[model samples]
Target: MQLVTSVNSHSIAVMLLTVLALFLFTREKIPLETSSLFIIVALTVGFTIFPYEYENKELHSIDFFSGFGHEALIAVCALMIAGQGLVRTGALEPVGRVLSKLWASSPKLSLLLTLIVGATLSAFVNNVPIVILLLPILTAVSIKTKTSASKVLMPMGFATLIGGMSTTIGTSTNLLVVSVAVDMGMRDFGMFDFIFPVLIAGSFAIVYLWLVVPYFIKERRAPLMDTSPRVFTAKLMITEESASKDQALNELILKTDGMMKVLRIHRNSNDMYVLPNSKTIIKAEDMLVVEDTPENLKSYEKILDAVLYSSLGAVDEEHPLLEEEQQIAEVIISQGSKLNNTTLSQSRFLQRHNLIALALHRSGKKTETVLKDIAEISLKIGDVLLIQGKNEHILELKQSRELLVLDATSDLTHTKQAPIAFFIMFGIVAVAALGILPIAISATLGVFLMFLTSCINWKDASNALNTQVILIVVASLALGGALLKTGAASYIAHLFVLSMDGMSTTFMLSGLMLLMAIMTNVVSNNAAAVIGTPIAIGIAQQLNLDPEPFVLAVLFGANMSYATPMAYKTNLLVMTAGGYTFGDFLKVGIPLTFIMWITFSWLLPLLYNI
Candidate 1:
């Protein structure tokens, strides 16, 4: 391709190199960290070879490297730390639990609640953390309801993105675009300055994601929870709030919805075991020996508010057995192991190992046994056990002849601290939204409170900062500066206007939004925002129109990164958990991007009165 002669030869060269960098990124030839570093090095070298001269100020190497110390980068890191605090403390657990219950009863209501709650909270909180908190809950709901995680996950991710587009602190890309605009002599925008336009565009996108996205993508499922697995004994203790309270034995059995079977019941009041009759009634603290299936146990617990008790009765409803560090894993009983010839009660398994067995999976058709007979049933070869313990203990078992650890790894949420953590996040958002404090100051204060309240430790806070994303953001900032200084930004703006020579303002704005949406999906959205904001400002200046609308276009377009797995970080996270492939995103997201483009084009001009 012949370079445009209107731009300086050196500026054209930088644009070519930028295109080459984007090519390498999309091809997945290297990690994002490495690709980001390449941009920093190449920009530094290019500026050193041929510097930009404006009046007397020349673009220097140090200028190219200044993005490493940019304020936007620092603020983004702080937000990540605060979000991590919320995650570790289980701040969103209450919301997740309520939604999971709603989903268990009705998928339609669940989708509606997820969209409303996710969009509203995400408007104030960062979208990444919002998605992080909701991911596990949605996955559990999908498993419990026999729905595909892929069907649920993408909509949740998209809702987070739509909400992120509505506020300045909602995403790093939004912050970057506003920072760029302010640097170009535009006034600093407020947290809610662009909210109206976002809502207008977001409303259209949200409707599509909620009603239409699921039907397009086929169901993707997790293997371990399929119907072929065996069922095991779980001691369920009735709570005061149990839905099965004061119900007949037949009614209680019907309440499990085929997920569990009541084999025997023990009355806490009489300290006596009773064979349950059809007319027998449930009471608080009644212990039921139930057969739990992998697919239905979680749903049953949510429905009844019951607690899983241990065989020794050491743990009751008030005390939790699993520690914070303990996680659940599925392990298979290997041949010739001691467990092959022994029963759990006879073998004293707890005395032998640190991990405690939560449930068991045996092959072949499941057989029903009475509580006494089943609790003492001899184990056979190839039995799968869901064991709960720490990593060290699990690894030790892996080296021995006991069992083979399976691939799946999961942990229980610490829902006890949900209220306090959520209140802290709310305070941070309130102060920032009211302009009571700057976002940076407010977010940093929230992080300190998180530490003081024991929401998260120093180690976890540090780990929350993803170095790869940090490198990418800083590098993109530097590349943006390079484009602006070398006049390539102006060149690109002129090319856009020339392509739409006699068109109306609406067409030009739509062209710009379409360009940004496509580019953001190909590269980093923050990178797209950093480079496009200046060109957008140039377009507005040339046309003698309000620059606010143009700037808003760049902000919204950069967030249209739903079309590819590599388009956004949250997409990468949901991939394995949802069992999603690249093709899955294409099936649902590519067409949606065009819809967003057209929606934004039609709505933005009216919203901004452009």
Candidate 2:
């Protein structure tokens, strides 16, 4: 293969466009999806304006579009669907429950356990799936422990990255480096060949992320001050199978472990009311009203397997409250509305609009009254209603003049095939770990199983595809290809090595890793690894030194993509979820990347005896 010089007109234009794309991404003045599309257009036009020859083949516009269909991007999109399957079926909820118990006792212990789980699982499985699996569990832990999600989410992401550096199968970046080395006539790194060195570096990083990074990341999520978040009212029916079947009212309260309070009890036989005392024994057909969030309510409802009742009569299991498209929104009954002064049951609100009132907030109203009956809740001029409905009805509220929808959140429902979904997820990791199939093939298979098992429908699966992440990754790959094909990266690599010819061999190795580290943060890591491998071999041959240490340097430095969110996909995932800024990555990532470089520079020479 042949390469073109950067002095060519097309190469200079590509470099200029690369710098502008970086500005658009780092400044974040526009959405990533839009910026990425602009980059694609720039490359397409630039290549068209000035064609160049490389390896005796002329560069064409089709070459630019090829990035969109890269294998790495396809694998990531498939992993996201597998993640959605785990979340949809609530397959990991049991794991979350155990973590919740630990978090209730100690936040530090819970974080340690979470980090351990993340690092160990990421060693064998890909890092992306590890983060996806732990995301919801940590969220539940955060809610239960009353900790801000910002504190733990980054540590979780970093843990997986460090672990990925330990094994070839850990991440595609590591595997690509090994494959490139093998193609260059070097032996492939065995499974544990690099684990010891990586664990040495990872140990220090884990401590910094666990103990130090949290203090730097302040809680950014504002506490929910609006009453809507806390307005969900749950109606739990007492059954003969209930543990508190015949227990006294006070004993039932004592048995609940502060889960909920029994506002009132109703007789199931006829139209009647029962005011119970400490000695009052609960009956099998008793109704209990409690205030709880939808998540907590689901737990309690599942524990009892009892029925839920409303003033509209006994609510069936098919209600929107438990549907995948179920949503809760805060709506204000507007002025001059027919809903004013009329109860929900009287207005036939569910019948008219296919919506149900979960709770109502009337400020300055008396607090001691048992007003859990959403059906009897009367609407007022300024009263806020927490409404629950399917997507159709939730969107329908926007068209109604009588109410104003302030905010809304949709709930996801899982299928009964949770066990199958969980099995498929486990099988994907197991097959890949055993080297029976490539990760891309195993993951692609897992996605097919998700659809076959009914874990996710076709529409829902399509919605999981984030075109923004896909396009940005594609555009970056194209830019890296442009750099390599133009001989830009190779030129820089050789020029630096030539400039440092007078330095000691150790110093040259250090300078090489440092360059790879910087380049990895700018371009994709796979590109950096591919570009750096030949440079490492060339430098080692010039110095009459072993090529192994320099090759290892390229591998380690390429994985140190910590300086920017765009440098790594896992970082981007956490960035969006944590609501982080570019400054956030610079805050901790720069120091860590520096540490990794210094650590490798210091340790590699001692281990390889350069």
Candidate 3:
């Protein structure tokens, strides 16, 4: 009786910690990595401070930090590097172009194509990089078609998540399951083990997305009137002391702000020079004609201390400047962008890029407040930036990866190493697929080749990695190990089985899957998998059933974090991009979650013979 009571006490303590971890994860009040680290420390200290005997041994003192070197964890990092190589080489551009052309005519068609392509690529590659690469291209297409970006972007992200579940290499979750199974002396899964079930699930998902998701989602339309207006106009003055005094007016405009137009520069005695080249110099009392909004005019006034002039009275008969010389373009924020959570003023976007934000569009709502003095407006994905700048400067800014240009101009002069990049990418994929090399080895090799071929320099390659993501993965793995070593996982599994006794295997599977889905909503999916895998294995051992189905159920369930915006990284990615409310996910996700649960519960036992 004493032993039973002691066991129960230990189990309760561990379960409480697990619950605490889940609560922290779901709230997103703390970073996932930080939450995981705390869980690990708590478990370690609990075990040491209040030791408990289990199975004739004191509860194992967990070396929670060793999961940093886990092979599955290392492979994920390597895959990220490989994906970076592919992006740097411009190898995916042709694929993106072909996809764009196929879906050019309709929003529905575009969504379907994006789903298909995203699913196919995610099966073999990392989903994170795939989504990152496709996001810009999809945004570009939305601009071209004038379609509400909200309609297709979320579906694209979901497609990648689904696709990642289709193959062993599709996501780290699949690989983690296989690794754990191998460690438990179970038959190792081949590369295509998940192909059949995934095909069925994926097919149903695609059809559902095409037929059902559209009906459920509300269409967020752009304004009928072009709320994106070019309102900023300013005048630039060239003085003897000005940095651009001796520079050509055109060159000076380029160097200063592309959005600022020099209507005319007058030397002494009203000698007006229009669009002067490098030879043009400023004499004393030289007046330069420039056009921008009042706020931008003020910025120019502050930056160059130039005198503000009223808007030029129609440089041409039609407007203030030639149509070819000046125009408006829309720019969208992207993932890993330095601009996320920053304001326009703080970003120095106007001062540095020479573009003025005339208006802002978010979640189908338009704001024309000029955004000059507002410092608290946080930039998010899918926020449209209506910028006014010269045609040449707009093109230059468009070329940058930080912002996706929404204008309808194609500039193909930028050189890209398409063929070499393709070959390198292919080599990496082939090596990993054939099992000739592990993904990490092949991916590292690919990164080196990228440098060798000059496909991407070191700076670009480094930018592709998300350090926070890597740290979260490592920390979660360590925490998961601590839970297992401290006997916390076994304790939870025993209690779950006890409470769920007399239930059918289907009921048990459903319950476990639902529990995992809930846990993932609060914590990292990888952490959920690591902690859940062992408990699932324990449950299977007690039930005298095959562990594969339960393990796969846990893996699949961990990824099905659709009910909350904080559930998965991809969920958060689309939240701001889609202008989604927290309630929005619950509206769409609850049904999807049920569908997946039912599909997997029925399918797992059949496939694995549990």
Specify the highest-TM-score model's number. Answer: 3
Q: Which regions of candidate 3 are displaced past 4 Å?
A: 1-14, 40-62, 105-110, 143-146, 180-187, 222-227, 235-335, 340-350, 358-369, 372-388, 402-415, 573-575
Q: Candidate 2: lDDT over CA atoms?
A: 0.67
TM-score of 3: 0.78
Cα lDDT tens digits, model 2, 381-441, are 4455666666678666643323434332222223477788789988877776677876668
lDDT of 3 at 468: 57
Error of 1 at 2 (Å): 25
Tens-place lDDT digits, model 3, residues 467-552: 55666566566555544555666656677888998988888988999988877766677768877888787778767788778888
Give the Å error, residue 252, model 3.
27
Q: Quote the lDDT for 266 in model 3.
A: 61
RMSD per prediction, one decimal? Answer: 15.5, 15.3, 7.3
* Selected candidate, larger TM-score, 1 vs 3: 3
Score each candidate by Cα lDDT: 0.71, 0.67, 0.66
Ranking by TM-score: 3, 1, 2
